[model samples]
Target: PSRSATLAALDVRKRRDFTVHDLDHRHHLWHEGDDARRWAREAAKRATVVLGNIEEVEMATGTRNPVAGAAALLDLGAKIAIVKRGGEGVYARTASEEVTVRPVEIPVLNGLGAGDAFGGALCHGLLAGWPLRRTLEAANAAGAIVASRLACADAMPTLAEIETVLARKVSA
Candidate 1:
């Protein structure tokens, strides 16, 4: 997975409003800093929303600098920079402020793709015109829904499930 960051970034660049700037630039098992930063600068030039996993970004960038990462997005004039922290929470940054949305309580079944689902749903929610708070809440709910199930792709929550959880009317 480490070696695929570039491909992933390319896909995001082509398909989405985001482009991944892998701090790790080379196709090697380990990342090359200059190459990563170069590519990141390029990604920042294109995308408005940047999504990254803490692990992948750190591995490629060779440094776990959230502020620097945030700065990159800022330099690119991105509106949102989302940093996914598994089990801990999700961090979101805009030009003016940064918010860390804590995770909801849910049993962990399979951790794989939880972050992807969260990012997808988060972006979807925002695109659907949900407020930032509601978007983060929905993303949090999506993460919980995936965690509650046994498989990764199969575990992704439906829109109804996300709304039900975000609504907070359903009891355990």
Candidate 2:
């Protein structure tokens, strides 16, 4: 954007550690000096993982198609790309694999903390060496629990809670 970068600390570097990028479109900034459409794609070059909502992914990759957007991110060097589809679940893609995890049905109470919970659970799953689909499934469950609750920190789900949802789904 034409407006100066607000967060100068944001830099995607070539690092040995795995990096996850949750796209946060800075729509408030002017785009005269920058191209907002390619921000996520550009950042993907240095990211190991990229995750965003459909709108955000479309804005970043210039495509509303989730599969194409994931491919676009992968083309830009991201190892994994995940498009959050809210209640429809998430579309996760890697060079060799792709998955669309089913959503956990729940009564919507407060959705404010869902994304945060999802991100935290994503990191937890990745760090724990879970496969992409398993990671997304647990992340989705964590988000579902948060959305079904009213509190903030207290609403954040535990690993047991997330696994319980997964276990139930499996048993069903």
Candidate 2 residue spans exceeding 4 A from truth = 1-13, 26-34
TM-score computed on alpha carbons, candidate 1: 0.70
Candidate 2, residues 1-172, lDDT tens digits: the string is 3222422223524533567778866567635766766555666665788889889898888888999998988887788899999878899899899999988888889998898899999999999998888899999999999999999788898899999988988888
Clash totals for all models, in order? 3, 1
Task: Provide the global lDDT of candidate 2 against the true structure.
Answer: 0.82
Estimate, for each residue in 1-172, the C-alpha lDDT of model 1 and write its tens digit.
5425655555556635433332322345444544655555555555566666665445434446765665555666567766666676777788787877777777887877676677778778777887776787788789888877889987889899888876662354
Q: Which residue ranges in model 1 land beyond 4 Å of their true spot?
A: 1-34, 59-68, 168-172
Model 1, CA-based lDDT: 0.65
- lDDT (C-alpha) at residue 168 in model 2: 89
